[model samples]
Target: MTREASPAQRTRALIIDAAADLLAASASGEFSTREVCDAAGVTAPTLYHHFGDKDGLLREVAADRFSRYLTRKQALETTGDPVEDFRRGWDMHVEFGVANPALYNIMYGRRIEGRTTPADHAHAVLVTMMRDLERAGRLRMPTGTAADMVASAAVGVTLHLIRTRAAADDHLSALVRDAVTAAVISPPTVPGAASVTPQLARAAAQLEAEMPHGSVGTLRASEATLLREWLTQLSVLGRMAGGAPS
Candidate 1:
């Protein structure tokens, strides 16, 4: 039997979809319960009933974006070369993005105008890649200031291309991977180095800093070590494959 959302979940999804539309329209970053009601075709009481109030509604809406983004990340795992795996993941990211353009905006495109966070969204993919890279022994360590800046630049460039609908733009997620890859991979880097230590470090630090201290400390250390080792090994393999300069 196909599983369907409970009545409550159905209502929640309806409210979330309405809020997403409103958020897209909120080019001014203004959010309001009244506006939500207008968007949702519901009265104040019903809106309040499902969610305590405006803040509550906004929180749920942001949470929904995280949930949707996470779901997409979780679905994309492939075996073989780590770089190939990353390419697959990027494909899914673009598929989800194009299919849910507004949700994509919430996760990546429109942070300045809203309170959406991508920590939950990037968690699974970052974690998995860190591990795989570690086992492959081609990761670097202390993915510090440089890594952080590079990541921001890469994602920003890719998302900018996507949002601007650049004529040279490939698929949205392909742009993300290529941008990320160009910044990440190096002669001393690994094959799937795009998801290497610096990128993972940035992801970890961002998530940890936002969490209630201690939430991601262990995960960070473990992932960091794995990433360093992974990048190391990948560098060797990449050289062997003639993908990296000797």
Candidate 2:
């Protein structure tokens, strides 16, 4: 069954939509509280009462816009090749930024703290992709480290395109993506080197590194404790099998 929005929710939605429209049409990629209130047919007091201030309202708008972009990316089918998946994710991120420069800038261009948003989910997805690569013995570095490199490069490229408003070269995103991927990934191993034990250990270590820092929405606290234990066991087994230090 579909639930209805309450009055407060409806008002909030109206304000966000109005602000989003203003932001999209804005030449400077910014909007004012008075502008939002006028568009939403509400007073300044109402806007402040609901959103605390202009920054708060814009933050919500950025989160909402980024969430929409994420929905589209999440809908794409995973082909099970983690490297290819990561490439595609990078491309999709660039596409979203180019399509919505104002909103993308709001979400990522400025540095801020203490804002809860779906941007974290996008990052979590990247970490999981790196973990998948680890499971296949394809990751050359730690999962978190690789994820950070990918994100930093991707954001830089996307923001550059947004700033210049250039006719984006299709090769630009792919070239940067390949460069970053190459730096962080190992080539395919021969049959013997492709043993499952070490791959398992690598994957566990990757997940362990991520679980503490990012959103592990799939596991509860107790469940994560048990999973960590199992991961440790797998890692130890892998080390024992390969006589390699982790």
List the global CA lDDT of all models: 0.56, 0.78
Residue 210 accuracy (lDDT) in model 2: 75
Judged by lDDT, which candidate is best?
A: 2
What is the C-alpha local distance difference test score of candidate 1?
A: 0.56
Give me the runs in candidate 2 sitting further than 4 Å from their true place.
190-246
List of clashing residue pairs for candidate 2: none
Give the CA lDDT, 0 to 100, for residue 111 in model 2.
48
Error (Å) of candidate 2 at residue 94 is 0.6
Candidate 1, position 104, lDDT? 54
lDDT of 2 by residue, 53-142 (tens): 777888888888888778888899988766677778888888888888888887787744556755676788889888988888777679
lDDT of 2: 0.78
Root mean square deviation (Cα) for candidate 1: 12.4
